[model samples]
Target: MQKAHTSFALALSLFLAVSCTNNKDAEQIAPSLSAEASQSSKDGILTSELSKPIGMSIDQKNQIWVSQSGTGKNDGSVVVVTPNGRVQTAFTGFGSQVLPNNELGGLGHVLYQDGMLYVLDGLNGRLYIIDVSSYKAKDAPVPASSLNFIAIKPFVLSQNLSNPLDSNLYDLTFGPDGRLYIADAGANAIISVNLATKALSVFARIPNATPTIQAVPTGIIYDGSKFLVSTLTGFPFVTGLAKVLQISTSGVVSDYRSGFTALTNLAPAKGDDLLVTEYARFVFSPPVVGWQPSTGRVANAAGTTVLGGLNEITDIERINPNFYYVLSTAEGTIQKLKY
Candidate 1:
């Protein structure tokens, strides 16, 4: 996902000419026994078969769903990985493209709720809905052409905004009011969708991280009372400039926390804290014009690092109180962190 910074910028420039874009449980064990169990259960690498995975979500049955922005050949897909590391392709053949920077662009973040999977396509600007209630681990892969989706670009372009021509529906979360709130990285705003009516509205426009750079809002989550959104600041991708914005249920946005770099996703932590993914720092030198490897990390809302040395980290999912699954697009692997 760090590669997206340059790729998306290139795409946005072209548009000026011609338009486009948890879990838990158990209480009987002693403190010592539980601590040992937690330590032993942290399987660092869940699976290494993913090809440029950009998003992830855990289901009711503890299955991890990942969206892969395939090798830019219209082969994008979503796969299901069991807790034991078993992987199965659930859907395939979505639109994908190889950006000018050689980065894969297409599939974005995914969400699973009540047996339904919400897949976001950043390249095409569409939200796909797939019914996976009966999709067992043994079920065969399904073709994306067979499913249904809602084209968000049309609705987003219809709204009056500073940048209405572009719409990249990057990440989404269901609010307390049951509306799907999406972080539009391209449009630099939060969009709300009425699931029942399929209506779209601009909830809030993200302010610029700096006077010259746009705030590319990426990951988002609703914490019962409000929405928390993360930003991957534009251009030079300056360090310690990205922030996590807090939005009221009614769409008022404000700075919740600052002093982070290239934030990609957010998750609820114990109490009022949050677990965020720092994708990576940008290297603008000619020899290394991309994300600096091993600079990504998992940090708390206070900007304290929980885990570091991550390469191109894209998303983070909290499975239980003691563990988190962190996705590294560069490594094409998920590392289970014991918190």
Candidate 2:
């Protein structure tokens, strides 16, 4: 186990981008861990082989968090791992235990706010508030079948808005002001929910004129002030536009960046830097999945940063001031980067 863990990390380290330097030489090549993998598992490293590492979030304690949805017959789950890759806890919800691999059960997206963890139920379209200290669902499931008639029933958040979300409620996060934000990729809208009163409102919606199959907003991140979002374009071949839409505390939305494809996730680096993963090749005949490292001053937003090529980037997080952690779903490896 130790050797396997080290090999995985070494493979993933090869792709981390060091700086915003457009020059190829400035890109940082991660040191191979194959030589040290013998010490990995013994050191408490955790690893996985799954379809996609769909979403992640960090708690006040700074523990790294992640969720994976299996393709079919795979039994999806949510995992909490230490900075060193040790498994903290893995959740396979009570009712979801019988869900098929690709049925979208288990955990889809996790959000940590105050001292609670909010998880979106992919199969049932329900939102569960989990006690961070306990890691258990606050209430039972709220089925879409009875959502309309119910009155803010069972953590539904709101009956005034759409209930039983259309499809996979992919990503979720809280804004700087404390209101809860969720990305409904299936419904094509970014929504904000009142945590205190269970009221729901659409924060941002993908325009129908986008000229893609359908827009699926997968990830949400707060850069201390605004909410940054990632949208997977609906059409194949056309690079899925991964854009950042800035939303103020007042619910104002503005275009931040586009032209990049498959912006699946985002994390803040030290200074004004961000680590963006580009799965540009996912829409092809055979999915060309890779991760890219890019850095730039915050003012530029997008389109001007120096972007490196893909390197199996599934999820990203700023583990510390200078180190960023990335997940490679296919490689089943986690990487640490210093930028």
TM-score of each: 0.87, 0.65
List lDDT for all candidates, in order: 0.76, 0.48
User: Tens digits of per-residue lDDT for model 2 on 97-161?
Assistant: 32321122434566655566666655455676655565432323333232221121233334222
> After superposition, which runs of candidate 2 have C-alpha atoms over 4 Å from their true positions?
1-52, 60-62, 71-74, 94-106, 134-165, 283-312
Q: In lDDT terms, which candidate is top?
A: 1
- Tens digit of lDDT per residue, candidate 1, span 30-140? 122234333434457778878778888877677789998776689989999876666789899987887665545688889887888899888788989888899887788
Model 2 vs. true fold: TM: 0.65
- Alpha-carbon error at 165 in model 2, in Å? 8.6
Q: How well does candidate 1 match the true structure in TM-score terms? A: 0.87
> Considering every candidate listed, which one attains the maximal TM-score?
1
